[model samples]
Target: MLEPLGVDATCELVYREMLTHPGEGVAALAQRLGLSREDVGIALDQLSSLALVRQSYEPSGRQRPVSPEVAMRILLERQSAELEAHQHRLALSRAAATQLIAEASEAMADPQQVGVELLVGIDRIREWLSQLATEIQGEVLTFAPDGAQTQDNMDASRPLNLGLLQRGVRLRTIYLESIRSDAPTLDHVRSLIRSGAEVRTAPLLPTRMIIADRRLAMLPVDDHDSGRGAVVFSESPTVQALHALFESVWERARVVGGAPPSSKDADLAPQDAAALKLLAEGHTVESIAKRLGVSPRTARRITTSLQDRLGARGRFEAGVKAVRRGWLPMRD
Candidate 1:
């Protein structure tokens, strides 16, 4: 067993070596441990580093010696209570999955039926999503309001989404604007798009959601934690209505490159707008002066106008406000 003390293999060999060669040379200890001389030398070196082994040299030999018990103690140290906490966590997860499976989430009567299933933990929620992805014969709607970018998120979703897409299930996903900069997340998402899941995004969103076949829905119980939160899957009318609301929002979102607006335009402006457009392109005063064919004084005046109009203190803030005000197009 893996232990805080370490593992069984290293412990037993070291124990036997200590007993057989309490004060023998390192080479003799290596033979007893069935390891290479270098390996035994290193292990003993480590023991001495910990002060469990003391070094001494015979007439012509140099090596440290150790007691058998010290080697065994190092090899067989007990794992901490922290590991027991992990075991407890595993038990809790299994219990949650089992509870819903036994109850069948109101789907046993009709495994393919339109119904509501209440899942109380994150694992159960992801488990249901995976199952629906496997069973869905038609469409899957996904609205990931929270940025799920962890190992558990991938573990619960990657295969499920891929399998559904591969089988020709129509998949739709909506992302928040903030998700664009996460390189790993985008790579995974791009792969899904290539696999046939249509993707879209918007500026701000709330809660994570998935609706399977327009009949069963799953959404977060809370946003702070993926695991501590709850999931609701229901064929219940109230649940379905809420799902439709999400769908309505999803439909209104722009698909990837559905319509990328024009970049900062010279035509869209007052001097402030024109100035911000120039600033976004990395223009300095001299550059803006040259571009607009204006004097340095005139360029600085334009910059001041832009910042004040946007209620900003600097050129960068003005550029930000310009984008927010639709003076520049947004891309993810």
Candidate 2:
């Protein structure tokens, strides 16, 4: 405790001796603690500065140990205030750093070469995305392919997503149909939606991509191996083409969290209805399993159960029966 208060061993010894012998003179404390008089004097000076010891009024040169409670309270309060001051400084530093990075990005970005830039690693890609998010001034469009919205992915994205939304950015995300049955992913999506994001789902997506402000787009260099890094497009033609593809998919995608109009759909659980829709879309069991974040066996089980419930002879027949019964929506 004394160490944290900047009390050295010699000072602590003198303080302890003073505690035992109240109003002890410097020479008396020095002799009692087996320390030289000069050492005791130095310790007294240190303790006095910390409010741990003070000169007695009755004997001007004699020292009295202050109450431990009072001394500790003063030290703790001072430390707390210093900590708060450091926190304020940290906040200002962060603001300054953000401003500097924004200025650097503007300086490095060239109008002639804005169309395409190669991001070489995951760290770099994340940095660029963070920078882009900070600079974004308009709507955000995202397309998430099957098996992409894991809990880890959502966790990593939450901060960036919330930051943009808090700044009044409009976010629209598209996910595969199978995610409707994924509890964790669906929960994350619901949270985003509640925070003013627009979410939709389709049986398939062209690729995983994010288009910000209709001016910039990012997609994996290799869809099968995202570790290959990403390609960012700021060029007009590429961005426009990606935007058009997103719009086409958006038009065909169903709005998540919407009410099921048909009585048959209303009677079934949402996940069950979603599975039926994927089946109608002709997604294979393995593909559905990946999309739903479940094993293929579970996907087959769901398909079999749906077939039995619809009184259909096979998976294809089940799809037809489900459509006729208004349990599955027909594709456009």
Best by lDDT: 2
lDDT of each: 0.61, 0.76
Error of 2 at 155 (Å): 2.1
Q: Model 1, 136-177: lDDT tens per residue?
A: 899888777654355667656788888888898899888754
TM-score of each: 0.45, 0.51
Question: Which digits, one per residue and each the tens of the lDDT, describe model 2 over residues 159-201?
Answer: 9999999999999999877677778888999999999999998
Worst 10 residues of 1 by lDDT: 75-84
Error of 1 at 243 (Å): 3.4
| Candidate 1 backbone overlaps, count | 7
Measured with C-alpha atoms, the lDDT of residue 299 in candidate 2 is 82
Weakest lDDT window of 10 consecutive positions for candidate 2? 102-111
